[model samples]
Target: MSTPLDATAIETIQGFDAEKRYKHLVKEVVANRKIWILIDEHGCVMLNTDDEDCVPVWPNKEFAEAWATGEWDNCKAESISLNKWHSRWTHGLEDDELAIVVFPIQDQEGLVIYPDELDYELKNQAKKQR
Candidate 1:
């Protein structure tokens, strides 16, 4: 079942101009192969269910590893390409009441921050650590 949006997640979404930021963020993620944690409003990691075209993604192995160990209070963390994630998983979400946030893949090492504000080298390093 889809989870509800929480206060922090709502604040994050409302803090940005979604229409203007969505395309730019997508470009940044695709160009850098950056990992992002797709969290619903309630801070639950978005997962790939029976859907074929859509899959949940993390920016790096570190974040994925944490989620796997229930660090994020969840047991599953999956990865998907930015293209499919944007076009498939997130499709129609903009019109729904539910809001999703693209959080930078962060671990104990450091934070990747946001999708639009990612350091390519740092992201790559995190991936390599996996």
Candidate 2:
């Protein structure tokens, strides 16, 4: 059975008039720089990095639902646009690392994590391994 749309999903759909509008936003943001929005099988959202595996991104709810059933482990996927995602969560990030923000339905305050100190820490780890 298809999952019912929640408040966030409804707001996201209404925010963009059509799928084309959503695609246009994605294209516009991606034109400036590569952007990735990471969303798990649940509603949790994060900012994906270049080093991570490719995650599916759907322009609208219909597409997300279709993919969610057969391919995405039967879990509903909710995503925010790159700009909206950045605006909502980027303020919490430190200058040195990639940020992962988790938005849970019950909680008003989202959790933010900087996985590593970006290039500096990763490079140091690499050097130590060599």
Top candidate (TM-score) = 1
Write down the lDDT that model 2 would get. Answer: 0.39
Model 2 scores worst on lDDT over the 10 consecutive residues at 101-110
lDDT (10s digit) by residue, model 1, range 23-110: 3344445555444553434643543223222223343434345445444554544455555544544444433322334332223212
By summed lDDT, the worst window of 10 consecutive residues in model 1 runs over 108-117
Stretches off by above 4 angstroms in model 2 are 1-51, 71-73, 79-83, 89-130
Taking all chains together, each candidate's TM-score versus the true structure is: 0.35, 0.30
Please give the CA lDDT of all the candidate structures. Answer: 0.41, 0.39
Badly placed stretches (over 4 Å) of model 1 are: 1-28, 32-57, 68-74, 104-130
lDDT of 2 by residue, 21-87 (tens): 4343244334432233335556433335455322334333454454443344446646554445345
Report per-prediction Cα RMSD to one decimal. 13.4, 15.4
User: Residue 23 of model 1: what lDDT?
Assistant: 37
